[model samples]
Target: MCPRCRGEALLWARVPYGWTNREGGRVEGRSGVVLCPACDARAPGAAALITWFHVHGRADDEDEEFVRLLVRWATGVSVPPLDEHAPEAENERWQRGDL
Candidate 1:
């Protein structure tokens, strides 16, 4: 249902690199904060997204795409592109286990 242990792998791999709070870490200007171990494992994806942003000149674009991919991975449903004025129905369905 969840891509065969993807969530477990992400969480377990990320837990160690995660900081309990944002105040004490070396401030790298990265928007999505993750633990070093998880970052290392997922570096390729992260780098690809960064490259996409660099070419497109839209920083938020990569974050938005990442969230959509995460949702699809977690819930096994394709989410429609988000709009600022509307709530995301797919998210609701995901929470309700309808997907």
Candidate 2:
């Protein structure tokens, strides 16, 4: 089970390093050491970038975007963490204006 989220066993998921959100704005993906969904309680960096950049190892020539992300993450740089919780989505909150 995940130690961070503490739910299902951390599945091998494919998360992007960075991408353009629905609004066409660029989103930055951190390559720094991230908290493991599990095992961190037992040890830090346990996940060892289990699933951050390039899932299958390295990026291919055809997928130029992957190559870029791979290099960006491989630089061995760690950025400060954002501990704040994400704000609720506008639609998720029902407002009186909706009537």
Candidate 3:
């Protein structure tokens, strides 16, 4: 989050990445491709991590530890691998209501 503007967490989706939000508007940030939805705060995010999130569908949404580590990752900081959160953690979210 931006220290000046208490922005929310960094969110990612399968959206087109452009230089500006709209009409070539200038954003105030340095060396970060990822943008915070609330305040447009820029944070460096790795492609590998983003790919992981896309493949896993944010399975650790409710995991506090995961969220903290995610924030760290967003800031271009190194964090340990998420071994605690295995594939099973995402199973419940994947089950459709077909029954």
Measured by lDDT, the strongest candidate is 3
TM-score for each prediction? Answer: 0.22, 0.21, 0.25
Sliding window of 10 residues with minimal summed lDDT for model 2 = 41-50
lDDT per residue as tens, model 3, 1-99? 534355643454232222444566844433333334444323354444444555765547687755654666555632233343556556655665322
Better of 1 and 3 by TM-score: 3
What lDDT tens digits, residue by residue, belong to model 1 across residues 1-99?
A: 123433322221111122223455542221222212233334434444434434654334247775553333333222233243345777788789987
- The all-Cα superposition gives candidate 1 an RMSD in Å to the true structure of 16.4
TM-score of candidate 2 versus the correct structure, residues matched by position: 0.21
Better of 2 and 3 by TM-score: 3
What digit string (tens of lDDT, one per residue) describes model 2 on residues 4-96?
466544233233356566698978764434333344433423334445332555435477665454444344334444333333344445453
How much is 76 displaced in model 1, in angstroms? 18
Estimate candidate 2's alpha-carbon lDDT, on a 0 to 1 scale.
0.44
lDDT of 3: 0.46
Local distance difference test, per candidate?
0.37, 0.44, 0.46
RMSD of each: 16.4, 13.4, 18.2
Model 2 alpha-carbon drift over 4 Å, by segment: 1-16, 31-85, 89-99
Clash list (residue pairs), candidate 3? none
Model 1 clash pairs?
17-35
